[model samples]
Target: MSTRGGGPDRRGVRAKVEAQRAAERRAERRRRVLLAAGAVVVVGGIVAVIVVNFPSSSSSSGLGPEGMALQTGPQLASVSSAASGQTVDGISCDSSEQVAYHIHSHLAVYVNGQQHSIPYGVGVVEPVPSTVNGGTFVSASQCYYWLHTHAQDGIIHVESPSQKQYTLGQFFDIWKQPLSTGQVGPASGHVTAYVNGKAFTGDPRTITLQPHEDIQLDVGTPVVPPQSVDWSHAQL
Candidate 1:
């Protein structure tokens, strides 16, 4: 009788020990799970902060008006002062468009790897009629400047009374914007210019507006390659 009772008591003690060990294992697993979840939350919060502060080029944080992608549509309106028929950089704003020295050049601008639109009617007078073309603004003004743009298609129309040399600096002058080695309009950075898909090492202001010339200016990092426009379908 004594031996049977002792055996039963030992069995009960063993069972209790086993149960205690199982409980301890479960508590350890729960602690591990809690730690892992906390780690994930911390990591997620860090990622969100980085995304908001340093948005990538593909991010919509830097989009232009109407949710337009940077450099893909009209970024700026025609300078208001330009409509006053004031002579800028020796270029004249006449009552009518000149055709004697009519020619076209393309100017593409990029700031921090994002393209910006050169906008229609850059040198045209106010109250200009505009239409949307492929999400871009196209304008036709009765009064015109020697250097004017009819569309936000990056085409610069050089229409003068006579055929003479015109520089990119003169165009910015008409646009009433600052241009230099460290800035392009309102964008400030190290200016890198390209002419006809070739890197230009000289002052961007000195860049001549040749017929059908492809001029590109990049400000800041992640420099984009010069883009070419097909002139076959473009009516100057």
Candidate 2:
């Protein structure tokens, strides 16, 4: 009879111990879940911060070939005479980049279906070493023409002291290159001109350098079609 009574007590104790252990296991699982959720939140926040802080250089809605990106090919020409602070076509070269009437335009050239790049420092004189906002050393020029370029991206920066009309002819003159319906730079043949993906019927030189305008010139046979570029992400 005593053995029977002791058996019930032992079984009851064993059941209680099992119940307590089950509760502890549940608590541990809950802790692990909470920790995992916290880690996910932290990682998500970091990704959001990175996305907001650093944007992509290329645009999602960009057109034409990806080769249109800046510095994709060899430079077309060196800096023209305007780089020496000489006045060309009434445009002056100042001691610094002017921002009073800042604007940007793009130009592209193709010879026999092959693309050529426009060089940086086209109208800037004597590039010097300087640090940018990110503490990166880059070539900064001593003088800047009203029409200039800071990269080999075919972007013509029109940073003038005053707002006024400028034309492709003036820029070419500043570049010390010749442009006409018959010729462009060193390449000579039947010249085809395009403005904003449309054939420009008038003198190619007379094409105005408007803000965000895309200009292209094709030389010789196998004239390439007008190409477009994504200016949406340009920092000009």
Query: Which candidate number would show the highest lDDT if scored against the true structure?
Result: 1
Model 1 lDDT, full chain set: 0.77
* lDDT per residue (tens digit) for residues 1-236 in model 2: 24376587788888999999999999999999999999999999999998888765343322222223554555566664444777888888878778999888899998778888777667777755343322212244567788876666688888999999999888888788888988887677888999999999788999998988999999887989988787764555
TM-scores for all predictions: 0.65, 0.78
**Model 2 regions lying over 4 Å from their true place:** 1-7, 48-68, 80-82, 128-139
**Scored by CA lDDT, what does every candidate get?**
0.77, 0.76
Worst 10 residues of 1 by lDDT: 61-70
lDDT of 1 by residue, 27-58 (tens): 99999999999999999999999888876656
| Global Cα RMSD, each model | 13.2, 4.3
Residue pairs in clash, model 2: none
Q: What is residue 128's positional error in candidate 2, in angstroms?
A: 4.3
